[model samples]
Target chain A: MKSEDLETVRMVVHARSGVAVDISKEYAIESRLAPLARRDSFADVGELVQAIRARRDEGLMWSVTEALIQGETCFFRDREPFALFRDDMLPALAARADRPVRVWSAACSTGQEPYSLAMIVDEVAPRFPGLKVELFASDLSERRLEKAQSGLYTQFEVQRGLPIRLLVRHFEKVEEVWRLSQSLRQMVRFRRINLLADLRALGQYDVIFCRNVISSLDPALRGRVLEQMAQALAPGGWLVLGQDERPMGLTEALESISGWDGAFGRNPAFRAAA
Target chain B: MKTCLVVDDSRVIRKVARRILEELGFEVAEAADGMEAMAWCRTAMPEAILLDWNMPLMDGLEFLRQLRKEPDGDQPIVVFCTVENDLEHIALALESGADEYIMKPFDGDILSVKLMEAGVLA
Candidate 1:
């Protein structure tokens, strides 16, 4: 990634995800753009960057981001997190809520995280009796959001992380592709959210899953992003990260806790302070 | 009649698989997702299964994992039909107990050859 192209990615990602990406991760940026460059038959990243700047199509911006963003997601990814949410998190949240429980899947690429959350909610919904559960899934990439909204996957996508029984019950066979049932599709609301924007307007969430997305960010920007995310989380609510990422040294507001592979809790003092 | 279960979420692939299997003289049953496939397998016991990898609810990998745990687990000659062309993915499929693995955009002839190799057809 050239300095100019890196700047463009940084600006776009910052605008969309609120995570400031450093130009230093040139290899990462270059690897992501290789496919786009090849697809467009551009000679190099420089040519691709030039073309991107010349074209003001909003769709192109999203495509660039989609190409760059790590959409390394599969159905029921990292079984431990979803398992923890189903077995421990939702029940606890349900007990505390007087009204419906709201879970936010921040940076929900292509809808895997939120859909996983919905499946868990659906399983426990019958037992909750009066408690209503709503899953709000958001991504920076409109293209990804569109795919999430479609709730359709190729045979390859369905195989990666999903279990068999759940596949049969929740999806319908259209031909060779698996499409999520109307019920499951309806459970999640896919929105294009710029995480760096005003998350205060998004309201409080019982559980915020911002996983596998922070690696793109610089430390300072990551800290700010986490602080904003913390503000959006309800007191005692949990925040889950990708297995490979950590909150340590990023923010003091979230304390690492023993649950869901690895999770962080809103500091009681920080909640009071906020 | 010999039965085969074509498990995938894509309508196009399922149609293609169904047409190919039907032409080969095997009874074809279809399931959209892993859960549905499991339910069908419980009562139907198809002789062969062509399973997709990525799906909603339960995915192909999880389906394979659960299928392997069943009492008559190794009954079907399971083939993984997916777009994940990575060698790691192929190894993972084989490790998960798939009897055969084929990449997507395949021709009917390849499907027939795989079926014959699995002893599902003469």
Candidate 2:
């Protein structure tokens, strides 16, 4: 692929979605777009790039962008985060008594993280009797959101990180696939959301999981997203970022909690009451 | 250390169970059949037994019956771990002196809860 076509692809993806694709990853673009080109009956990658450059193919552009952003995720992908949330976070939140706890699983790929949160909340909520826990999951892709909303997973998907006990208790086997129990499905509300967009409409959350997403964006966009996440969290709320990402150069509204790499507590000085 | 005897024909199942049970602070043992499990118990009975429903040499039901006749056999917490989920099968296991029953493909959290309920772990 020529430099011009690569630039065109990058511009369209960035303009439509906040995803930053590196020009060095021209091969990645080619591999991802080749199938789209074939399906759309384009002559070649250059032709597809030209079609995207033409500016009228909003549908094609969106499809290409969405394809690039859909990430591979699994239930309880990292055991440490879920363990910290259950053993430490939930119990601490239960003591507050100010309101029922609200959790947000940002960039939830296919509903696993949110469902995992739901299962933990289900176990802990009974202890707090009156506490009304709300689990909200969001992603940038509508296609992924549709799959997430269904709460169905393949055998391989469940096998990734899901414990067999949780599988047997919370999910029912539907032929070869596993369907999340209705009660668990109802625990989460899925929505189409871009981190670069306004998050006020999603409301403030007591715990926000914005993991493994910022590393994909450029440094500037990463900062902006972190700032927005800080704003979206309630006063004294927690923000959990990906292990590799941090708010050091991005935002100062969140202060890292001791002993956990990805966990942050909202700085009361910067947080306005929600 | 509290000891647990895992009886199953499959080495994979035994390994998985051993990993989970060990994490919960149990000294784990393995037996491929009921007869082998009985022989181990005669030497020194485990604090808990994770019994598999089906196996060669002797099945779980016969093993449980023979186990109950031994001194201090009734003291061990016996949990039947298998793929059998029917009411008839569960009833048969319970009647044969199984203290608890759980399906295969189990996870550590559920295993912990089951063990807690069985008074095998504090």
Q: Which regions of candidate 1 fall more than 4 Å away from where they truly are?
A: A1-45, A51-62, A258-261, A271-274, B1-122
Under CAPRI classification, how is model 2 graded? incorrect
RMSD for each model, in Å, please? 11.9, 6.2
Tens digits of lDDT, candidate 1, A1-274: 5677789877766555555555798998887878878887999877877777888556656666677666778766766788788878888877887877878998888887788788888888898887788889998777788999999987666655554445656876677777899999999988888776767899988888888877766566787778888888887888888888887788777788864567788776654234
lDDT of each: 0.79, 0.83
DockQ of 2: 0.08
- Give the top-scoring candidate (lDDT): 2
User: DockQ scores for all the models shown?
Assistant: 0.04, 0.08
Interface RMSD of 2: 7.4
List TM-score per model, in order: 0.65, 0.72
Q: TM-score per model for chain B alone?
A: 0.96, 0.97
Q: Which portion of correct inter-chain contacts appears in model 2?
A: 0.00
Q: For candidate 1, what is the TM-score?
A: 0.65
Which window of 10 residues has the lowest lDDT sum in candidate 1 chain A? A159-168
